[model samples]
Every structure is written in structure tokens, then in C-alpha cells.
Target: MSAVPNQAGSWSTLETPLSEPIMETLGLLGFDAMTPVQAGAIPLFMKNKDVVVEAVTGSGKTLAFVIPIIEKLTRREDPLKKHEIGALIITPTRELAQQIHSVFSTFIDDHPKKDQLTLGLFIGGTTTLAQDITTFNQSCPRILIGTPGRLEELLTRSQKIVNTKELEVLVMDEADRLLDMGFSQQLSRIIAQLPKQRRTGLFSATMTDAISELVRAGLRNPVRIVVKVEDLTSKGSVQRTPASLDINYIVCDPEQKLIQLVRLLQAELNDMEGARKFIVYFATCACVDYFYKLLKQIGDLKPFSLHSLHGQMDTKRRTATYTNFTQLPPAVPAVLLCTDVASRGLDIPDVDYVIQIDPPQDPKAFTHRCGRAARAGRKGKATVFLIRGREETYIEFLKLRKIPLERGYYRLEDGSVCDNVLKNDDAEDEKITTSEVEDASVAPFIATLRAIVKKDRDMHDRGMKAFVSWARAYSKHEASFIFRLKDVDLGRVATGYGLLKVQKCPN
Candidate 1:
């Protein structure tokens, strides 16, 4: 079924000026009308001026920039040449590149009368170098999207396939993140290889002084478009103030944090009516991995699965995981367990929740993570899970922006946990006293062997039935229960799947 626009009744008469294919794609994607960013930036970008667009995440930033570029490129009178990277979109992370690339693919797939043009994506988290390089060298994709380092490496090495001089448009998506991750020098190197006359555009959810200087240096007297004025705060409105997004901060201690998260997800899932997919973020892969497995094993509710996108997995697996999740909406609602690296301007819609399983190392990341949901006039929720010892930095971070956090939680005085207290509505004793450190700093990792059963409820007759078998496989590592991607056999899974001749792994 084609996606229907919310305002289809009068959209055709407004001289909206979208190409017939784009209009159709819009209708197919259910984009009812032009967003504020799209409304302002599209026309300016269609004029081919260098553009710097600053808007919050989930504000339809994708279409704001994408429609104009697509409109300009596909409608061009000249035929695109082979082996030339005509349009380049540079992103900060591999996950984002893959995510945006998937979006473009979907949009183009549904677009009618799309020109027969080669498109290439250069992202990490996948180990398909030969396939990617072949596409790069031979296809000369009209639109080239990639992360900074990989794209740069390919350009410097692939003399046989690339013609940077032929590039007509350059886009730096998430310029702040690219710079934050120390991509400034890499960006500069990549820029030097492109034609100076090419049109340049930079898009970000927020702006810092560093990003401003980047725009001035990269763009030619660029047109600046800030859609934040339409942003709302203290409310869920998507169109007007430092004030469209309502900021909700929940303070809890480490003790009851997991329970709080489970409650949060259940509420979000139930309330959203399963419309939005959630991105549950953690500080480290281990945190994500441990929680994901524990939930799967302990909870009898559903066949919940977890995916880790850290460096532990090779590039190919990581790319495949991201591709699978963002390919299209899930068959049913699902949760994405990821790190901060996956948070940025990947336009996933209908997301109502952004759950920070761990507090972000930096404050700016808070905005980016929250941007996942509550998009385009849609009411979304951003929940941060905080513990006691980390209060000083976390509180100071919020204070920097004048946002007040509310303290609340289920409870903290459980027998097992005492390290991090829970968020308490009772503030008389809000600050966790040092005497509560019984469970240890990393209490969450070492689940009580018996409670693991109590938490999941299905270990014996149902979920993760292979835990004991798999756990037996990793006796050397002394992991209580063993595991594998899926099905490596109990003993072999315990010993680490196939140094000899393994059959299967832990389920």
C-alpha cells in the first residue's frame, strides 16, 4: 500500500513543486505535508546554494535535505557520467551511514521514473570490501554516501574508479559529531580532494561554535536555515521554541534501575500502541550484551533478542545487523540495544521512546539520543536512567542548560543491590548514603544465579533452555552461563565454538 500524506486533499494545488516521483514517494511514505525545515530548506537548496541547516533530530531533517537534492539531481538535464561520484554525503558513524543509505534506497525504490543511476554506499560495520570497491570503481555511483575514514581511504586508494572533480554536491551530515569524533582533519583531507566549486551543505540537529567554523570554511557564503525556533520545550509540540520538545529526566539509583527500565519500556510499548520502535542505549557493549541476554533468559513474555554493534563483531556482521533492523519497520515492535555511536541524524519515524540505559558521557549526546522519537509534531518520550554516585556530573550537565530533573523510582533497598540506589520520590533521603555499597559497583553484571530464574521465569521449560548447556561450554572463562550468536552446541559453545570441529552453539 502506498503511504498517504496527512494533507493529501489540498497538497496538489499548492504548487508544492515536488517532482511527480517525489510526490508519489511522499504519498507512499505517508509524509502528509512539508515540515518546517523542508518548507524552508528545500527551495534554497533547489537553487543550488551552499546551505547550512540546523534543526533538532526527528524534525524531518532527512527529507528537508534529501528532497531538494533528489529534486535537483534526478531532474538534471545532463546525463550522469560513469565512474564519477556526482553527489557525496559524508556521515560520522558507520551505523548512521548504513541507516541513511537504507532510507535513500527505500525512497528511491518506491520512486517512479527514477533514472537508471548507480548509487554507492561506503560504510563500516561490514566486511564487503571487494563488493564495495567494485561498486565504487565501476558504478561511479551518482550519489556516494559514506563515513569519513572509509570514504577517504577508498578515494586515496582507488585511482581506477573515482573522479572527485566530477562531484557537483557535497553534504556533511552531523557535522558536530564528525568533528567530535576527531574527524575534522579527516574531513579536511576528504574535502581537499573534491572540487572547490561543488555546492556544499552541512546539516546538524544542534550547533556548537566548532560546527559554525566548519560551515564557514566549507561552504561558500552559505544560506543558513535554523528550524529550532519552531522547536518546543516543556511540551511535546514539534513546531515553535527552545520550548516543542518536553524534557523528562528520571533520577534513580543503580539498585532498582533495571526494574525501572523494564517498567518504562512496558509503558512506552503499551502506550505507543506498538507504533514506534525504540532505541535503548547503553554506555558499553558489555552492559547491552549482559542486559539483553538476562532479559531474554529471565522474561517469559516473548522471544526478545539483542544485537551488539560494538567492535567485537566484525564489520560485516555489524552492518548486517543495522541493515536488518532499519530495513523497514519490524514485523512486530522491537528494541535496538546500541551504544552512542548509533545515535544521530538517521531519520527513523514514529519512535515514541529513547531509553538511555546508561547516562551519556557528554550532555550534547542527550539531545541527539532524544531526537530518536517525538518527531514532526508527534509526542515522544526521552527517559534518562541515572544512579547516585554519577549525580554530580549528571546534575551539572543538566544545569548547564537550565533543565531541572525530577527524582523518582520504584525502590532501592532490595536485598541484593546496594551500590547504586534507585530514583526515589521520597527526597528526605534522596542522596544515597555510602553505607549502601553491598552488591558492589558492577552488581548488575553478576546476577544472582537463583534470581536469574526468578527474573526471566522461563529458564526451565522455555526461554534460553540452552543456557546450562552453553554455560558448560565456557568453563575456562568461568562464565556462569555460556552463550553464542545462536546454536554452537553446549560443550563447544563453552569452549569457544570450533577450534576443533564444532556442530552447533548456545541458542
Candidate 2:
């Protein structure tokens, strides 16, 4: 079934009416209507049936499971003890887990029986295992949310501290990403310990064979719900991303990539009506680190709030950055430079644009990345920066998957690319003609980047590492036919990285 916007479905429309507290909380959260996934899956979950929900990101998959979990716990005939968990939600990343936990908190906090129900977050890096165990023992959270590794460890090593005999619902959020990240073994172990009669829901944006195997193993005669998005551009065609998302791609020389990005960001910052929150995706953690530093040094971007998030950062830093970015005021113009770690299952509010410095190696991730914007029927835009030539074919590759793309242009001002850029579908707009390497602003920007790497040994080392990691990641692209590493120009790629010089990466 395809997901309809909030208008078509409402909380009041559910067959088994939600508890009064749940209804009141939904009203407080401003959720006037149910999304398609919510409308479809909520009733099945309420009926105590296992569900496999495959929906687009930002289609309100969180609430589809969250509400049911709350409803089940609240209506339980046997009240759960403090340490006895009733529902367990396992997502792939800590950020996603945190987001889900927040949603649970929103409903739990407002419910009249909020005091009776408790919530716990057990992801790694935020706290030590001993600390988590202590909290679990003390608080006895009724609903537990965590990542697979920590949840597996907690369930396996400290069974006494983490009780699951009463576990009522088990959810694998972003189920496909869990398998893609090689967490199948952990998921299997976690599932084995849970009671077979418990409700199990596997929620993901894209369904894969591995997820099907997981469903077969974990769920019992589950009802499958696929919430597809209708493509507004073409009739009778389905889109993986939201209809409100405008996906565009920009083709530029390798050396001009950074200049193009800086100019685009500057343009966005200057546009009062444009997006204030931006997510810039880098190919690797090293790239995020290097670019985060590089972009911070640029004079024009200094006034805007710039932050970086990657998988390598310590738990506290990652949690802090995620919290900081999410809580930023709507009026503040902020940009989060991150890797694909920030891509899936994270609901950052009012994200105006998602800029991909490069396409992800995984094809499915493209949909997830764009889903960050244009979420929940809100207007959003995404543009990927691709190198000219063969990389341009990626556009067609995505088209084959029903992901449409439009040409993204570089907006220029006074003979150089400037703000108010990447507004597609305007044929009368003047195209940028300045040679990227020779452009007045771009030439100075590239020089400054090179000089920073040359003068600072640490910065220089970071650039080299980022370039090599990027190349290695590109070589392993799922669509290697298009993003072939050998077809790349090492010299120009190095120039694009602002590296002091190119050096062969040791195999």
C-alpha cells in the first residue's frame, strides 16, 4: 500500500482506538493524521501480529512501532517490574537509536501513566557497560532501545541485569542497514534470547533478501506492509524517496568540487528564503574530518554554524554533536558535515538541503540520504556532486531504480559561482562559464586549502589519508562499473583534496 499524507488517515480512524493518553499525546505532538505506514501497521501490531514494515524514511516508521509498543505496555494485564523490559528496539547506529528513544520519550512523558512506564537507552559510547547495567538495575525501564552490539552484549553477558522474560515487542529498526553493517550475527543472537511469542517488527526503508531471512527467523506469520511513495513527476511510477524531495546532480571537474561546494553553501547562507539547515555528506570519515577543518578555515563560512559527525568520533562527542545539531534554533543557519552514519533513520527537523560531496558506495543509501530532506511531506532538496565523464552515468544508474534526477547548475555572480545556486528547471538562467581552476574566487580558495595542508603537518597528513580512503571507498562502490577507480585521474583528485602531492597508497 502507498503512504498517504496526514490528511488521508487520522489517529481517530484506527479500528482499535488508541488509549486516551496516547490520543492526547498525539494531539500535543501535532500529529493530526496517520501516515500510511502508521495507518497500516499500527492496527496489525495492536492485534498482536508481527509486522514487517518497509517504508520510505521519514514516513513516520518510528511512530508506527513506538505507539504500539507504548499501547501494549500500558494495557498489559500484568504490570512490568522496574527492571523487566516489555519492548526492545534495536537500530544500527547510536544516532538512530537516540532518535527513536527521543520519540518514545515524547509519548511516554506526556502519557498519564508516564510514571508507571520507564525508558532506557543502552547504546555504547554514551556510557560504560557497568554504568548501563547499574542504570538498568536501578530504573528497571519497561521499554529498552539500543544498538545491536551493546544490546547483544547486555543480553548475553549480563542477563541477570537485563531481564527479557517479559519482553513483549522486539523491533529491528533500519533492519537492512543492520545486516549491511555486518550485524546479522548479533541480531541472530539477540533474537534467539527473546521469547518466541513476543511481537516482532522489522522496519526498514529498503527490504533485502537478508531482511527476509531475518523476518522468517524472528517473526511468526507476520503481516507485511510496504508503504511506497508515488512519483509526482511521472504517473503510475513509484519513487523510493518522498514526492516533495527534489533530487539534482551537479557535474564539475575534480579540482572544482570544493570550490563548488563552498560557493553553493555561501549562496544558501545568503538566501533568506532558502534552507537554513544543511547536511553535507562525505565519502569517508577521514574526508569528513579534513573537510570539517578545511571548511571552518574558509573566511566566508566562519559566521555560519559548521559541525562534523562521523562514526570514528568517540561516543560522547558523537552524541553531543548529534544533540547540538538537532537542537539548533530554526533561525540559525547550520551545516552538518558527516558521513553516511548520519543518513539512515535520523529525523533532523527542517533540513532544507542534503548535499552529497560524493555518491555513497551503496546504491540504496542514495534514497536514505535524500530522505533526510523532504521528510514527512515537507519540501526539501538534495544535490550530489559528481565528477564529469563516467561518473555522470550514475544519474542513469539511479534512474533505472526509479530515482529521478535533474541537472544542478552552479549559480554565478560577478563572473564566479555564488549563492542562490542549484535551483533547477530554469532554462533562462545564465550558466557558469569560468574555468574552475581559473575562476577568481575558486583559484584563491584552492590555494588557501593547499597552503593550509602544506604548512600544517597534521592537516597535510589528514588530507593524504582522506584522499586514499576516498579512493579505496570509491573502488569498492556497489556499482563499480561506473565509479571505477582506475578511470580516475589521481593528480586531479589530489588537487581536489587540496593535497600537497599525490602518493601511491600501499596495497
Instruction: Identify the candidate with maximal TM-score.
Output: 2
Off by over 4 Å in 2: 1-7, 159-161, 413-441
In model 2, pairs of residues that clash are 82-140, 83-140, 267-419
Q: Mark the 10 consecutive residues where model 1 has the least summed lDDT.
A: 492-501
What is the per-residue lDDT of model 1 for residues 1-507, given as tens digits with 9 covering 90 to 100? 112233223235434477777777778778777766666666667677788887767666666666666766777677666666668889987767766677677667766535534568888545455667876666557788899987887777666467777677888988888888899988888888888888888888767898888887788888887764322234443432123345554544344455555555555445546434677887655445555555654352253334545545667777677766665454456677776766776655555567786556566777777767766767666677654432424555565554444443332323222233344554444443222333242244224423554454443222232333223332322211221123222332211111122334323
Candidate 2 TM-score, true structure as reference? 0.93
Candidate 2's residue-wise lDDT over 1-507, tens digit each? 333343457798888999988888889879998888888889889999898988888988899999999889888888987567899999999888888888888888867888667888989776888888888888888888999998998888885677789999999999999999999999999998888879999898888899889888899998888887778768789878888899998877788788787778788777778788999999999999999998888887886799999999998899899889989998898999999998998899989999999899999999999889988889999999987667877887999998989877765434253333334644242333222334455567678889878888899889989999998898888999888887778888898888868978633
TM-score of each: 0.73, 0.93
Clashes of 1: 32
The CA lDDT of each predicted structure is 0.60, 0.85
